[model samples]
Target: MSGIEELDEDRLGALAHKLDRPLVLIGLMGTGKSTIGRRIAGMLGLDFVDADDEIVHASQRSISEIFDEFGEDYFREGERRVIARLMTENKGVIATGGGAFVNDETRALILKQGIAIWLDCDIDTLVERTSRRNTRPLLKQGGPREILTRLKEERSGAYSRAQVHVVTGDLPHHETAMQVLEALEKWL
Candidate 1:
């Protein structure tokens, strides 16, 4: 959790006060949105809500199970609703599912009601990170690299509309969060 530079708490407070809406993170999976969002929220003294978790809670099923029981379309509809509700109910950091922002309604809602930050990383890193989990329905059918690569190509257009874009390399999660904090400072 050690970062290269010590974060300035006073600066974080100032930035947090400047926030007008939720900080919504949009990206492909394995981009560290949940982890970095938690760090950023802690640093800013804000709440952290993972939209995926909310979806699971509301549905009473895991994401993969939801996909298995219904389908991607059904899951997406629920995801949009969940994200919209979160936007209205929480003025904090929100980490969205990879495909959530691809939904037109969800994308529009985030762009209008929150500061969207897109986190991206290389395919190799994505494969490695996503390998740790077996819960991703999208990757369940194909090779993770191929699915992830195609996902990036298809979703980059929507994700590119984010207010801020950060590419995370081999940095530690804390450093990646620091980068997001710096980007937010500059954007705000």
Candidate 2:
């Protein structure tokens, strides 16, 4: 589909059927991965799984609680394991935690077993979007702008390795979702 208007559910489902691996979204926090993943799943008639939510479910604790209790290294190990398991067990769209794709082991596994899509966003946009939520443990440690900027810079290299890259912005979620769908059309 060229645009949202041209996208029909049947057409989306057809594209989804052509997919052989889980579509993993890699990006910094507040890049609309979860929201857009859900939209993509609904459009494609595929199941949706958020890696962070799955991590929460598997650990029986909030992500903040995990980080606060066990620290980032411990939380990351669990994240890597959780993501690896999700890759094998899930065949739909997976919206990963921001740091998930940045880990060496997790990035390698995702690259091998999943179709990676990098949802890139500007530092300004990230700051604005992330402000809507105060539960981000990383942001709690420092200023959101500085933290997000450093994160976007540090993670860009890993994210660039994704099979497909979509530069997203402050547009409506559906517009971005349609853009992703259109990109996947060319991809799958």
Candidate 3:
């Protein structure tokens, strides 16, 4: 199993079967958490959940609307609740919002209930990917590169507490997912 295309299905299945808890992906925005998480869940025969999507569903509003109507504090509180509920209900691949892991309570909950994996990436890649969309709340305040740089610095310590760390580059999503699988193989 040198590469994703050459990976042995039986070996991959065996590795997935060995997992005892949910795999929670924590990272800055544009780190490919949602994209890679879905692939990992499919590979492992588990469910895939995006925390922000769940938050939107629960709130019945867009994240921007939630922020505008309720403020970030309100949104964070709701996010914490939604994550706790998700963590308690199922063992799967959970892609969290960028700020979710930065919150102490949410981070503690994730650590307690799941195997947290930090999908780290360089600032250039983050900026490039994030620039494709203008939906990010944090980026709305400033340039993507500047905002992402500050976020990386501020949240690096929190993200470092994850159980596994997978460095992502400007590669295909499957390649990054394969790296996560390799990290999980070592971690488990």
Candidate 4:
């Protein structure tokens, strides 16, 4: 599949069957990991699991609530456990929390159990994309730019460790999803 025209459900399902393994997306917040992961899952006829959503489900509270109540270290631990659970499951697309890959233990867990795709995005695009969303606890602590810098400083290396990397600069959501699908085509 080379373009939008080739990304019909049949072709996508075939690609999913070809990979037959969980595909994990690693990237900063608002880089479209969750959005693209869901698209990929839909195209492939597979389930979609967002690491943050899983953590929320497991904790019975939102991520900000977790951090506000228990703290980031506590939230990170919860993220680690939730990611570990999702990585070991059947074929699906798992969109990891931005910080999940930064943890050595969680990074190792994902690398061992699944293929990691770094959803690359420029800082400008990220700021624009994330600005519309208010649910991000980290960015709320300070200026969005400063928070992004801190996150990039800390998590860039782990994102680099991914088996595949896709640069997603200002692309449409479906196009971004198709790019991820095309990247996995070779490995599949």
Candidate 5:
């Protein structure tokens, strides 16, 4: 659980020095993208912006509310707009929604502007992590394993397309963040 445990420190440090802007965190619901993105941004002394949060701000409604009132399609379109705006801003860490990467336009937009890090985690771990929260609309039914299975099948390919993939099931948030930075350091 040590900070940045999955990555070689020397390589990440070197990459951190050369970075021109904040990195982007992309992955499934419970992969710790928001938690770890904030930590990584703090470590690098950069701002952190969660695209979902931005979406909420612009719409003046929570994600759950959006899903409840406007349905998934509207929420998703709003997400695309929020992500597009976030990408255009100055350097700042960004954490995208789970569904955002699945959209062709959103995926292409992220790939073009930022270093996308996929916080890969096993289905069990994702289910466990997400179980503690109620903000997820897709997960409100049936069982966790079933939901995970569907999500994995639907988004695995898009997630795999990330510039850097960091496994995070057994690691703490700090360690995961470090690993992401480390892998990205060498990658960039």
Candidate 6:
């Protein structure tokens, strides 16, 4: 078996038993929070939720449509409410929108209700990953690298407040998920 398979088989039970609270992943848009969060949740035998998806469901609108129709402030307020509700109702891995942790209220709620994990990735990795998609609203205003750099500067402090910090790179999603599990194990 491969190293990853061995890791997963060996660690799954221990990791699943260690989860006492929700795992909230915070990071930039292309940092693989959703992907890694799903992997982690699967390993831990828990459900995975994307906060953005929850917001879209609650609002009955696409995120882009919400931003276009109601403006960023309105969308952010809605996001905060959705995240808060999800935390109270669900217990599993939650991948938050890139800007969700930047909101102080949302951040506070995450801190109180879950163990936040920051998926730290370098700017080049973020740019390359994000370049694959054009649906990102913030990237429409500037180059992917530039926008990610600016966001990294603005949001790194907030992300640093997370209970666990796992640096991600151009690795397989499961590998990154393993890194998050390692960090969470240490934190727990």
User: TM-score for all predictions?
Assistant: 0.96, 0.95, 0.96, 0.91, 0.90, 0.93
Q: Residues 1-188, candidate 5: write the lDDT tens digits.
A: 34445455565456667776557788889989899989888777678999988888888888999999999998888898888888888477899888998989988888888778888889988888999988898887778889888998889899899888988866767766677776776687
Compose the digit string of candidate 6's lDDT tens values, residues 1-188.
13444555557778777677799999999999998999888888899999998888888998888888888999999999989988987789999999999999999999999999999999999988998988788888877788899999999999999999988889888788877787787677
For model 1, how big is the CA root-mean-square deviation? 2.1
State the local distance difference test value for candidate 3.
0.90
Residue by residue across 20-59, what tens digits does model 3's lDDT show? 7789999999999999999989987899999999999988
Look at candidate 6 and tell me the lDDT of residue 183. Answer: 73
Ranking by lDDT: 1, 2, 3, 6, 4, 5
Candidate 4: which stretches are off by over 4 Å? 1-11
Give a tens-digit lDDT track for model 2, residues 58-117: 989999999999999999999999899899998999999999998999999999999999
lDDT per model vs. reference? 0.92, 0.91, 0.90, 0.86, 0.82, 0.88
| lDDT assessment of candidate 1 | 0.92
TM-score of 6: 0.93
- As a whole number from 0 to 100, the lDDT of residue 80 in candidate 3 is 97
Stretches of candidate 5 off by over 4 Å are: 1-14
Task: Write out the backbone clash pairs for model 4.
Answer: none
Clashes of each: 0, 0, 0, 0, 1, 0
Top lDDT: which candidate number?
1
User: On residues 80-141, what C-alpha lDDT tens digit does candidate 4 reach at each position?
Assistant: 98888787775689999898888999989888888899998888888998999899999879
- Clash tally for model 1: 0
Model 6 residue pairs with clashes:
none
Error of 4 at 42 (Å): 0.8
Q: Residue pairs in steric clash, candidate 3?
A: none
For model 1, the superposed segments whose C-alpha errors exceed 4 Å read 1-7
